[model samples]
Target: METVRTRPGAGRQGGSGRRLTRRQAVGALVAEAGGSPLRRTMGVGQLTLLSVGATLGTGIFVVLGQAVPQAGPAIVVSFVLAGVTALFSALSYAELAGMIPGSGSSYSYAYATMGELIAWVCGWCLILEYGVSVAAVAVGWGQYVNELLRLTVGVTLPDALSAPPGAGGTLNVPAALIVVLAMAVLLRGAKESAVANTVMVTVKIAALVMFCAVAFTAFRAGNFQPLFPLGTAGMSAGAASLFFSYIGFDAASTAGEEARNPQRDLPRAIILSLVLVTALYVLVAVAALGAMPWRQFAGTEATLSEVLVRSVGGGNLWPVLLSVGAVVATTSVVLTVQYGQIRILFAMSRDGLVPPLFSKVHPTTGVPRANTVIVSAFIAVLAALVPLGSLADATSIGTLFAFMLVNLAVVLLRHRNPDAPRSFRVPFSPVTPVLGMGFCVYMLFSLGADTWIAFAAWMAAGLAVYGLYGIRHSKLDHGAGPQEGA
Candidate 1:
């Protein structure tokens, strides 16, 4: 067991009973990484596929329709902006992931460099980012599932079973069902889920490539006439919406314990996945917009399918194939993101932050089965009852907050441990992280008032949980196995 010894005069607990310093936290993380049993079956290609699969889901299929109405053709600019912000954060993540090589993602980074309270807050924010994101994607997935059923089987799920409580129905059965199924795959093992993700990503990519090919055939230069109809503010708002699409590249970093050579491969995969996903997103956006007026995208639940039907003229197989692609895409997103969430919680639990049940990695499968079940149950409830719009807003805000903290952590680590080995470094140290933080803050404010309200409530709840339970139960306070007083 790894233990972090508390300081007498240097650090304060921040209400967690016993505080953890940067050096002590790093020691604990390193010890834990050494003792982990996760299988390192992923290479750069598999890791890249994981990031791409996690990223290329609802953002491309569902968000485009919502963003286009805000910025017209300038939604393309929004994609670039979101990509740039993600690039900065990805570079930061690469640097930290290379150094830490642990499973907690940004939450781990924060713990190692910032302290326990900051780490706890970072983990809580991630719950909003990943957990809520799965719910949102499941809700979006429900749309494609409904469309696929109607297109292929000539059947539509009734509103009572198809829509969420806030979306004119008692529950979204398909959304809830998909979450449950994903939980089953995750419970199997990391390598198993990864293999499944690879096949799904390949088919999903083929479908997008087909959509782009057919869309380009009907492309019209006239569609580019009014590029910025809603102006800069509208473009910024569109960027905020599009930002959610770029939130999953760091999902690659969450698998550090299961990586062959995390220090080198994790950084490479993070940057490579970002480049590939961005290129695909830009191509798809250009193709779709060139093929149809941006105004037509607004209020479209299944925009890509609509684009396929309109471009190729309906009564064909292409639209149905595209609908299937959307299902595969969003399903992959839920899978990868849910995987990231569980690993982060498992890391926290191992450190005696949350309940010990979350840290119980099954001996046979080398997976956190209990954590997966808990997360699945919680997300399924949200997917079945909550509105997608609310869940999405919370996700964007949470992800942006986590990204900002990650950028800050990178700078702090560099100053605190200049001798630490870093296979990859963020090119322009303070400048890059500073700019990344600025972008995150800008996007946070761009989110609606309701999102802010929801975020505040969630944080309040997290703080309460920490004070009432996490503080007294922390391993650092309990004198876990061995002591490392940094």
Candidate 2:
């Protein structure tokens, strides 16, 4: 029952008009209860598992090979660096999530503190972040699926079917299929997806732990020599690449509308999931480095599996076991990240920034069925066509841009609403958020020139969409304020 305000001439392009007050943003949740509301069934445990599941795959299993060659054995340090950078943004996300508690994550935060236009930009960046990252992870999953098939049946899919176009395959069939499978799971409901993710997260965690035990048996102190062979620049580049690994730590924030007690659980889940994932990432990196030479990782895929086999000898069963874990791991990542992406679109649709079909929740399942199907279909096609390295870099740049805005949003909100109730407040206020912005900029710079060009193109396309459609159709422009309930 909060009053809503609309700006009469707010439809003007480029202006920061029609901003949602913090109270208005939170109040929309209550209003939606009478409409097609998302079920509030997730607890803190499920939220943590959702973040962990979304995070624990791709990077360690697949990108570790790509990153190790850049930083040598010092790739261990690169993981730590990326984690610290993610820590700063995670703090910002925690504060805003507790205060706003919306499905849009950073998009909602921008709408509250900035304006609808900025929020549209942020939402567009999230589309790149989640959508492309899911495709990247699915591409990696195809590799593990190949390995698993090799060990079990002494067969693998043909290269044309198993890999993306530039990577020797005409289309990555397994990658596309995995996304389709995750789409089916999501169509069930959020609670069911959480249950499935919990099981997968457990399997992946256990698999990594098993890898550590076997790898440590062959740990060599000499492997640590020449740690800085690629120099500090190499280490920074590696950190930028590995930053993609930490992208899903704030995933719990995307579940604000579905969490049973979002104000209390969202902050705890965001911080806890990041801390846990960082610790595990560092440990796994150390184990792999000690067991193998950094130079050998250059062209390797299925790195952890290879490390386990090489460490324990060819006849051992560890590689097969690790492959199983990897399959489960990547599957969960695709599921949870797609879930987050759909929720972000749902929020945007509710604000009249996207098509209304995205926000329509199915009564029986309490999920956005059409949105899930359409997004998953596009992601599947992207996974089928794009190379993993390109997708990963694109996702990293987009995620970094979105995170920079989230950090800025925190400072702006604090300045504008000094006495606003916050279950969690980032320590040191503007200093922490400013450092967060600085770190994001540094990582963004570390990315290659081609990545920048691609990002620029993506941003240009987003602006075009906003100008053509989003600006004209925005709820605020119609003197209805933000859409409320059905």
Candidate 3:
């Protein structure tokens, strides 16, 4: 085990006052863990399912209803465009994941290739990406749960307990409840959480498959008329909204430290998950558009349920069955995204970039229990009080910002260290990274004006935190040598 200054007992400023160069940060990351390493137990299949489970939820079930109105039947085109944009960035992430094999995701890559300050900012962006996303998914899960109850038991959650304050409700109790439940699951440990994730993933996939199967029975060629009714501008807008669906495919890379075979498996999991998710998304989009007029999909909360009722006859049992599936799908999304956020906190804390409490792994469970508790508490409050639309937009911008940094890292590393061993290299190097960066920038600007303003404010807060604490107290700032120089 690497003996480094990671505990609360270690002095804050005990080492020589010097910042870590990018090269030194990379060396320290690859050479040492701040304490005993995280357990290596996950194989490629488990890692791939984690990515799929995280990526598949919320966006498909919740955002599709909102997006369909933006592009009419051409929402199918929007899905394709967004998937392509995510693919470029996913490729860059795969290359970095194979080479770095660390837990910090894009933040760790930026630290190794850019510098500590930039990495701190990237880590902060992930806080918004993963943290806000969990809250957003939990809110969506609450909506589905209410819908399921209404469908199956002829009851609805009272508005006071169903919606956030911003949405005209006192508190979203169901949303908050699911977040706490997911936190409890994670506290049990990684393997246990992974097992839960796999089961939920199967349930979600079966749900989507059922939707496609029934929707196809009602396929009407006339439903696709005026394919581009809203024009290129609307299609582009829908693509931007739909991009949030792809957010968690990179969750696979966050498991690098725990993967039993990171070098070969990480890249495979990243690519495989993206491919599977994109295919599933396309199928779902086509089936929905084929089943009904796209204009009818706008602003509906229980979109898939409505479609199922209309297609299979409302008095039957299929709609209720599908509503149950929607509940499971959104819950799985909350579980997986919450899991990713804690691991990122674990990585950042181990490097002394955040509070050491975040790195406090449980002795028996081998999980970052303290980190999960802290993150879950904050997210639960957000889910209870915040509106879903704002949370979703904020998460999209944060993710796009991180994607830009990851692409830049791949470009910088290629030029700086051509000889570095990489298990997976991004094909067509400079072109791919440049295109990835360009796509991310385009989508970043495509977001709503309010989202940009909120993102700027979030960045300002992160910079303030970094200047006050992260910069001064970083283990890297203290020149902690590889292996602690003992």
Candidate 4:
């Protein structure tokens, strides 16, 4: 093998780990740019926009309907809990993004600190958080699109082609369409895609603020009575569901190489983006949940915006705008989600842990064409074929696992490579990561049995893929690898 093994915790046990040097990371970025596609397609501004684009999507709109009855008015604390948990992981991610500063985010970190096996597992968990996360968003998007159609044009989509296979429907057609559209945009290159996403982000922000301002005007205190009506059980359930809304914040890390100065920008983007999204979510939840009784909100996906029009007298104008906002947000999320997936594959491909085809950037677009297609198809199938709640819960479980790994990694990296350059460090070191880990673990078990079962199945499938393909193909296996100390 090489001077140092390329496994999780491998860095701790020995000599220099065979991690990719910063130069190698930068070189691969250049090679994948059609050998130079978009010379400078991103900056601090674009990076921040991408962060916002990735994060401010479907969760806020649909999740409120699901969460309101569960936590009552205390759903606010649940959101805060979820956001705090995310901040812990974000702090961990900040350190890794600065130190590794490469594509694949946590996967790359696991590779450098742990090894290929851990990296594969981390990548697999991403399916729940990143890949399936998008599919979940697409399902939410389906709900909104149909809502808009019925409200404005009086054209209701049939349930058969509108939901996943598990939801007693034939297909989720809108979800698949959005995935396809995202793939097309990704194939065009990052700069143009970022531009489109910027517009979508703006729309999403406007819709969120408008929703809060409008609902706040018609607020009533009586709706707060019997808060936590279902007891702590309900509040816990709401917190678990709200986890879905924060999925996109990690997308900031995937731009490790593309950032103007990753050391500085990545940390800023991660923390800043989380703060921004959390603040918006709190405002919207307070306004929407406060305006109506929680018992009336259950079992309906269009509860928030519908309540807005009913309470505020906006009629069709406001609800339509909210629907449009959700659609735009979901579309942009698909784009950024696919982008992160491709770049992670690209990183793995370059390291020879995956088929070389995934590393090949399109001649024209400079994007990883094959990987993008595969991820896009994966999302489309789930969107078109399945309408399962268990899948969404499983997604949260997966994301929490991935975040736990990243959090633990922060501690591991510090002790292993104390000399390594870090643009940001998590405060209180082990305590923060430990708390982060505990928080995620709690959420992981909080998922229902069916969701846990689904998560296990995904993990099993990923193991098979890695065992059959990754270890054998890994560049580190044959002693062909990056610099030892960099």
Q: List runs of model 2 lying over 4 Å from the truth.
A: 1-4, 7-36, 69-73, 164-168, 225-237, 293-302, 314-316, 386-392, 482-486
- Please provide, for model 2 over 83-135, each residue's C-alpha lDDT reduced to its tens digit, 9 standing for 90 to 100: 99899999999999888887989888877666666788789889988998889
TM-score for all models, in order of appearance? 0.92, 0.90, 0.91, 0.88
Candidate 4 residue spans exceeding 4 A from truth: 1-40, 164-171, 221-237, 298-302, 387-389, 483-486
Candidate 2 vs 4: which has more lDDT: 2
For model 3, where is the 10-residue window of minimal lDDT? 15-24
> Candidate 3 residues 168-254, lDDT tens each?
899999999999999999888788888998999999899889889988999988888888999988998888888877888899888
Q: lDDT per residue, candidate 1, 1-486, as tens digits?
A: 234455443333443233544233565576677678777778888888888888888667767778889888988888888788789999998888888889999988887766677888999999888898889889889988998999899999999998987889998999999999999999889889999999999989998899899899999978977888889888878877777778799999889998888888999989999998888888898998998888788777537768777666867488788888989999999999999999989888877789999988899998988899999999999999988675467777788889999999988877767777788889989899989999888888877899888888889999898888776676666556333334
lDDT of each residue in 282-343, candidate 4, tens digit only: 88888887777677677776456887976788678887888898888888888887788777
- Model 2: what TM-score? 0.90
Residue 211, model 1: lDDT of: 86
What's the lDDT for candidate 3?
A: 0.82
- Residue 98 in candidate 1 has what lDDT? 84
RMSD value for candidate 2: 3.6
lDDT of each: 0.83, 0.84, 0.82, 0.75
Better of 1 and 2 by TM-score: 1
Please report the candidate that would top lDDT against the real structure: 2
RMSD (Å) per prediction: 3.1, 3.6, 4.1, 4.6
Return whichever of 1 and 2 wins on lDDT.
2
- Candidate 1: list runs displaced more than 4 Å: 1-23, 226-234, 298-302, 387-392, 481-486
